[model samples]
Target: MNEFRHVTVLLRETVSALRPRPGGHYLDGTAGGGGHTGLLLEKIQHTGRIEALDRDPDAIAALKKRFAGEPAVTVTQGNFFQAARLFPHPGFHGILLDLGVSSHQLDTPERGFSFHTSAPLDMRMEQDGPTARDLVNTLDEPSLRRILRDYAQEKYAPQIARAMVAQRSAAPIETTTQLADLIAAAVPAAYRREGHPARKTFMALRYACNGELDGLEEALLSLFNLLQPEGRLAVITFNSLEDAAMKRAARQLTAGCTCPPEFPVCVCGKSPRAHSLKPVFPSPEEIERNPRARSAKLRVLERR
Candidate 1:
């Protein structure tokens, strides 16, 4: 746990959105390194409790060790999407969902999340199930292209997919560096110079391998529904795909009057369930301190 160093992103901004109180129960959905969990605990005092939930085994271990013997903190290991089953007694005052990989995961080379290292292509956060290596070595070219295009919006998905299939046919694409270099060479020289061509491809593969975006809306709604009246749900997203999902969930909850304009009168009687707070972004100073925080955005919604 001591080595699990992660610079908490938008720490104050995200937790402050929750507007914690001393006796109100809350949840830290991502709980990586327990950064958000710690801040949430600080503001909440000792009256109520918080559940720190995470999907990664490493994070779960770290969180458990960090908050050991603390009555106010209950560390749980599992995806927050199933939070309903995890915490059956709802009426949560606030809930947070920090979406994306943590710095610890990327910094640890053997985890194979970053292309900077030459480790085996294993991006499984749980350190279980299928890995990036499995997908890259097994999936057909069209499937690979679709993953790249849909997940990361990679413009050169076709070329990259073709290159991966061509390279893997001769030998298994078993390493992060192998895939990264192949992607670098497959794209145009100009695109290569712009940035690492493998960045998007890697992101897409990780997202697919982990099923990150799958059923995201349903999960958000489930968590939101757990909130008590006037309770808030704050979410921090790193990628456009995740941000878009957050936006859709917020809109769906806050939407009202389902009847069409052509009807000229309400019929279905639909009304807003929740309302959003102003979205927050990292400060320039925060971004300079940690470049990864630059892409982070915080959105909060309070139940009606």
Candidate 2:
């Protein structure tokens, strides 16, 4: 198995934001490589407990190996969106969800997460779903265009989708480089010069394959509900789509009564449940050390 080498983004910042203390029970909703969870374990010591979950089988194996024989740690294989059901006992002291692709997934060519590789177009986080090859080869142009536009916010989504369908009709687009080269050719040369032509397309496929943004806001709210009063739900997002959903969830939690100014008496019993702190970004030094961490943003919402 390839080494699960994932640099935990915003490590100190996220743990500090969560404020894990001895005897506090916390949750690492996405325990990829167990970086953040390992550090949090140190802070909490033997007194505290941590419930770690991940959809990736490799991640689950790594976490189990890393935390084995440690009674305080429990590693489970599942999606963070279903945290409430999976972790029936709520009232967690803190919950963290780091929504970024693991470095191992991208670096390992077989994962097909990066367009730079020449592997099969298979970017399944859980490793059991329709791959990028299946989507590009089978989906219609309009659906393909929608995935690109909605998931990655690709500006040339229509052109890319049209080209993808046209090329696949002749023969199935099979590999990472095949699709990457096709995208490079489809977009204008000027756009290609700006950056990788396939980056957005690849990201869109990963998102679609994993259902990353679907029911995302509701999931965020559910995770927040799992936290006890004053417990923090710290999430780290890599792109605008996820950040927007996180912001919306935080806004929903922080929103108070909806009664109008004209109403003299209190009507809506709804009050603020949580408040978000200032978003955290990677430091210049950290970014220089690991360029992949550049786009990460950490947002912490405290339950009231």
Can you give the TM-score per candidate against the true fold? 0.97, 0.98
- Cα displacement (Å) at residue 88, model 1: 1.3
- For each candidate in the order shown, give its overall lDDT on alpha carbons: 0.92, 0.92
Sliding window of 10 residues with minimal summed lDDT for model 2: 1-10
Residue 269 miss distance in model 1 (angstroms): 1.7
- Residue 91 lDDT in model 1? 94
State residue 233's C-alpha deviation in candidate 1, in Å. 0.5
**Displacement of the residue 265 alpha carbon in candidate 1, Å:** 4.5
Model 2, which residues run further than 4 Å from truth?
none
Model 1 residue 55 distance off true place after TM-score fit, in angstroms: 0.5
Q: Provide the lDDT at 271 for model 1.
A: 94
Instruction: Note the residue pairs that clash in candidate 2.
Output: none
